[model samples]
Target chain A: EPEVTQTPSHQVTQMGQEVILRCVPISNHLYFYWYRQILGQKVEFLVSFYNNEISEKSEIFDDQFSVERPDGSNFTLKIRSTKLEDSAMYFCATSQGVYNSPLHFGNGTRLTVT
Target chain B: GENVGLHLPTLSVQEGDNSIINCAYSNSASDYFIWYKQESGKGPQFIIDIRSNMDKRQGQRVTVLLNKTVKHLSLQIAATQPGDSAVYFCAESPSGGSQGNLIFGKGTKLSVKP
Candidate 1:
């Protein structure tokens, strides 16, 4: 089966620094999403993108957070200024853009802000 | 407001035994639900999903039950194996459309004792 692939399995960055997480969804998938999971907490939805634009976003997605499909097949999440609380696993997922379709998730990028 | 939660944070089962994980959601409008298994340091992997119109759905060795009236969902794994040990999460699509953006629950860690 096709899988979403994320770069930089683990990233360590200083507080207030910038970090960009990259992901490549399956070739035919049309919808993309970003989710965050704190060390031992529930996963939280950050944002969703379709048609090269954000379709919906959660309150957790604030000004400091941004997502872009720089080019076809590449989805990226950028944190303008990282904070200690930003330490967590970020997962990228994609779907076939159909009703009730399951989203395929990548292994994830572990980000640690010190 | 949307909330999804697991009844137990951890579950222990013997190999070859059956394991069940339970979840509850506060959003009555949520029509789509999914169960994901997450191994350490990895993203949530899709296991099975069910829509509100259906009361039950089964996969190879996994079954998902959805009760819209009680707003409850459950996943049952038959003949649990050591490989099945992981953190299980139940998620719901608040918008009930395509399940693009999901509201995830605090995971239930399944431990299979061999």
Candidate 2:
């Protein structure tokens, strides 16, 4: 079974610095998503991408956040200026389709902003 | 506002006992639902999923029951084992959105005691 791979399983960044989380999705997947879970909180949706464009995004995906599939393979999430509130486990998910398909998730990157 | 939530925060059961976790959703129009399991340092892994057209679906040792009438969902694990200990989350697609825009519940932590 293929799996979505994320880099730097743990990341620690200082406040006001930039950070970019990377994910290598399954080669055949067409849809990609980013979700984050704060300590002892529910997972929250941040953004979704398809066909080289952002399909939908949540209010939490503010102007400071951006996503790109720059090489048509690797998906990345960039935060312009990290804040303490940004500390959480960031997960990258991919699916072959959008409707009934289950999203396959990566192990996740734990980002800690201080 | 759309909200998906679990009824319990934690459940403890004997290794050989069965476990049942419950979830409630406020969106009646949600047609797709999924149950995911997350271990300590991993992302959510798909356990089972059901569509509005089905009332119950079963896999290896897991069963998912959907009660659309009451807007509820449940996951039952038979002969629970220590390996089954994890946080389980139920998620649903927003009423007017695709599955990529899943809204996850608060999650229920299951603990199996040997």
Candidate 3:
């Protein structure tokens, strides 16, 4: 069973500072996604990537947020300026790019903006 | 304005008892649905999934039911154990040529007594 792995289990940053979270999805998976869960809130979809480009994104993924597969195995999300409202657990997931395929998720990176 | 939502916020069941969590989706075009379990401080783990074409699917001790007419989804856990205590979310995807985004429901916290 393959798994997605994320780095920096917990992150604390000052408001307006830049931050980058990294994730390594299961090998051989073709689709990747980023989602966020605010405290006591539902998991919200932020963006989905496939074939090295963003296939779709939610309104929450504004100009401040960007994603890149810097390398073959690493997917990274960068926030140019962290805001207080950005405090949440960010999860990275991957799937086989087929309908109804399960999305395997990483443990998550908790970002706390001060 | 499609949304996924749960009927309850929390549930408690004795060890060895069965547990059920329910959700509703407003999207008539949704093609797939999944249930995820998240322990505190972790990302969601996929439990089970069902497609609109199927009414029931079972895996291990868990079962998922999809009722498309009323836009309802449910997860059933038999002989719930302490490890089953977690927050559960039902997610839907309108993947029939859609960009493949998942809408997650407000989670329901399930607590299994020892």
Clashing pairs in 1: none
Q: Chain B vs. true chain B: TM-score for each candidate?
A: 0.89, 0.90, 0.89
Q: Please give the TM-score for the first chain of candidate 3.
A: 0.98
Query: Which candidate's TM-score is highest?
Result: 2
Task: Quantify how close model 3 is to the true structure by its C-alpha RMSD in Å.
Answer: 3.5
Ranked candidates (DockQ, high to low): 1, 2, 3
DockQ of each: 0.46, 0.44, 0.42
**Where is model 2 more than 4 Å wrong at Cα?**
B1-8
Residue A20 CA displacement from its true place in model 2, Å: 0.6
Off by over 4 Å in 1: B1-8, B96-99
> Could you give candidate 2's per-residue lDDT for residues A78-102 as a string of tens digits?
9999999999889999999857899
Clashes of 1: 0
- TM-score of each predicted structure versus truth: 0.94, 0.95, 0.94
Per-residue lDDT of candidate 3, residues A1-114 (tens digit): 788999999999999999999999899899999999877577889999999999999999999999999878899999999999999889999999876688888989999999
Report the lDDT tens digits of candidate 3 across residue range B1-114.
111243448899999999999998868898889999988777889999888889999999999988888999999999999999988889998755444488888878898999
Q: Which of candidates 1 and 2 reaches a greater TM-score?
A: 2
Q: Of the candidates numbered 2 and 3, which has the greater lDDT value?
A: 2
Candidate 2 iRMSD, 1 decimal: 6.2
* Highest DockQ scorer: 1
lDDT of 1 by residue, A17-100 (tens): 999999999999999999987775678889999999899898899999999988787899999999999998899999998887
Q: Is the docking of candidate 2 incorrect, acceptable, medium or high quality?
A: acceptable
